[model samples]
Target: MVRKLLFVATLSVASGFKVDQAPVKTALLQLRGGADATQIAKYVAYSTSAFMFIPAGRDVFSPGAEIMPDDDKLLGKMFTDKSKEGYMFMWNQWGVNWIMLSIMKILAVSSGSADFLKLGFATDVVTFAMMFKGWIPEFKPFVVMFGLELLALGKLAFA
Candidate 1:
């Protein structure tokens, strides 16, 4: 009985330290040649953000948009149906920021640098804070956007 118990213990200990012959693949390993998860996630995040301009046109981009809760909204009534200037201001603001981020992501991917992902991570943090703080109203599309940002953040962090 004692011999059998000792043999079992030894086998368990040996198996615990057993190393697989196969190379352990990771995101870092994928970084060498082809597109890694980080690059894909970054591209997805930026591209999705850029395309948001289309869907948002009904709200912030148009004059007399229906989404404005109040005329004196912080974003400015002029940007809403209250005035032409306010609408233009909000529209340009969205376009510029979204487009710039997308361009940065493209540059980062093509250059094979993780530097630009840092910006994306930071932006995600701020956006999340805004959402949680109620500065930005919660909506179904925003939830989806938040999930994409989270995915990018995870890849950025691990990579």
Candidate 2:
């Protein structure tokens, strides 16, 4: 019982801090063919911060202790953010950050340092908005299928 509890606790902490696109990590770690260590460290620090804000306040996840009122408010806020007006504003803020990180990831991957996948995660947001505002007229799932961003397992339909 104690071992199982410990495993669960470890998993939670690991999952909480796990950011996507690890290729960025490898590129900066190239000591032999890399630039000054201090410079790389600074860059990494900035990139780490950029990642946190990339998803537009994705760090605003609810804590385990806030299982009641806080969780309810958070659900409500997510709904509000999904609304047409809120979605656009939030997406703009998040989209800018995502584009910056994507550029960095692309540089790192194409330079033979890190071979991480291109993390073009924000294209989905724009795609969703298009579908909602009657831009993409289709009855399918509209999966991007590029960066493992969307997964439509079952059948999808718009009514």
Candidate 3:
């Protein structure tokens, strides 16, 4: 099962190169109202990760929810519960990371700077390491985030 998952991830990453094609790029650009293809792809990856976690929001927002079972729940509470320090950590610090990365990616592509892309890739690596090193309370979000990150990494690698 793990091998199958790895293979799928590899395939998805490899397929990111397809976005570079003229037809696909044109369609994506039109779909995004003239946004860069690579940027669109990267945002799709981030959006996919966010969407995957949406289902778990119910558990975190439940009226009786208190102690969290794992990092996912804790992370969710960090968003819904403003009284906790984790809320600030999640919104002010952790959540800002993605926005910053997105800006870095845009600058990297726009300036044709390999350095920025390298930095973005490095940040993604560290983020993945931190996420995976922790215990996984749920399988769906983990797998979805991992897969989408792989796709993003693939595009970043080529960009």
Candidate 4:
């Protein structure tokens, strides 16, 4: 029974180590031209859209005590509507960011350099700042996103 318990513990530790190293391994592989360009592009698309949604959601749901005037334009109204505001705003923000990032990623892949990836990552950092500008005055989200962006930039740069 003691031997079995030790074996299980060792296996669990090894599994956790592998999980932590997965991203690094993938980054090394990508650097060696072993990664698929299409797949990388897809990841960039998904990640940027997902990141943009966070701010939009916060804006709609957590606008704080101050209320802005109702926007009169169609797109503005759709995004500012009380009931469906969060979803609409998220969708709208995601759409714009997604397109921009998609183009940048495509250009990066085409040029065979990771500069555009870094640029995209930087753009995200800025977006996060703008997103939380007046809402919370908190640095936690920005810091977290900054760390993630650094990791992403490192992966792309080495790729």
What are the Cα lDDT values of the candidates? 0.61, 0.41, 0.57, 0.55
Better of 1 and 4 by lDDT: 1
Worst 10-residue lDDT window, candidate 2: 150-159
Q: What TM-scores do the predictions have? A: 0.52, 0.23, 0.43, 0.34
State the RMSD for candidate 1. Answer: 13.7
- Give the range of the ten consecutive residues with the poorest summed lDDT in model 3: 55-64
Model 3 lDDT per residue over 1-159, tens place: 999999999999999877653555567577778788577666755564454333334333442244333655554533576677665444444435544555665565556576766676676666667767764555345555655655665575675
Q: Per-residue lDDT of 1-159 in model 4, one digit per residue for the tens? A: 999999999999998887443454477676867766545644654464456444544444553212232212223423444576476566555555555564665466446566776776677666666656744334455456555654555466555
* Reference-based lDDT, residue 30, model 2: 74
Highest-scoring model, TM-score = 1
Which digits, one per residue and each the tens of the lDDT, describe model 1 over residues 1-159?
A: 999999999999999999879656677666665666666776776666666555455434553444533423444523445445555666666756666765665565456566666666676667767767764433445656766865775576456
Error of 1 at 60 (Å): 9.2
Model 4, 97: alpha-carbon shift in Å?
4.1
Q: What's the lDDT of the predicted structure labeled candidate 3? A: 0.57
Question: Could you tell me the C-alpha RMSD of candidate 3 in Å?
Answer: 17.4
Positional deviation of 88 in candidate 1, in angstroms? 1.8
lDDT accuracy of residue 110 in candidate 1: 54
Clashes in each model (backbone N, CA, C under 3 Å)?
Answer: 5, 0, 0, 0
